[model samples]
Target: MSAATARATIQAYYDAFNAGNAAGMLDRVTEDIEHRVNEGAIRHGRALFAEFCSHMGVSYREELRDMVIFVSEDGTRGAAEFVVHGEYLQTDPGLPEARGQRYVLPAGAFFDLKGDRISRVTTFYNLNDWIAQVST
Candidate 1:
């Protein structure tokens, strides 16, 4: 894939995410996609990704900051970096819950591409930051 295509695919993935459609996002990823979270190990397959999204539930809002894209020299993979701000609207036991008003937390993600879609995703952020904000 060309740099332009890689960048486009990265943007499209986020578009699907912002649309609150995990399946839609998964549709654009490769079948054996490997997703890694900063807090854990590898999460394989689109199905596992969907289960994660379901566990997290719907977000009331997300603020993406200085989002940038980087395509690998091989042209078969790409990565993205950005500060993601999210409001807790739904509930997830694995994650924190806001009891009043809302909260804004920073998040980030890095996805690898295979042809026209992402085949791997590595995410990074401070889970402790989220815990500190909601633990109260």
Candidate 2:
């Protein structure tokens, strides 16, 4: 894939996310997608990703803003930086209790392309910052 096409693919994934179209976002990834989360375990497979989305939907509502996407010259890698504007709706196990706390966090994600789809997604953010915001 060319760099332009790779960038477009990543943009489409984020667009899907911003639209709250989880299925559309999943379509942009491979069946055996590898997901690496900051301060969390690495997980694999589209099914797991879907499950994660469901859980997140119940716990929080978020949107990405000020997104900047970058693609490798060879079009096999990409990265995106964005701000997450979100509300904590429900508490997850081992996390602070939620009462509709709002937070703004800067986050980034790195991607690995396989063919035309994303094979790997690794994301990072400041967990302590999030905890602090929601705890207050």
Candidate 1 Cα deviation (angstroms), residue 30 = 0.7
| RMSD vs true structure, all candidates | 2.4, 0.7
lDDT of 1 by residue, 1-136 (tens): 8778888888888877777777777788898989898878688987888877776555445556677778877657777777766666765557666564354566667767778888888888887877676666
Cand. 2 TM to true fold:
0.98
Best candidate according to TM-score: 2
lDDT of 2 by residue, 1-136 (tens): 8899899999999999888888889999999999999988888999999988788878998999999999999999999999999999999899999999999999999999988899999999999999999999
- Please report the TM-score between candidate 1 and the true structure: 0.82
**Clashing pairs counted in every model:** 0, 0
Cα-based lDDT for every prediction: 0.74, 0.94
Candidate 2, which ten residues in sequence have the lowest lDDT sum?
49-58
Error of 1 at 79 (Å): 2.1
Alpha-carbon error at 73 in model 1, in Å? Answer: 3.5
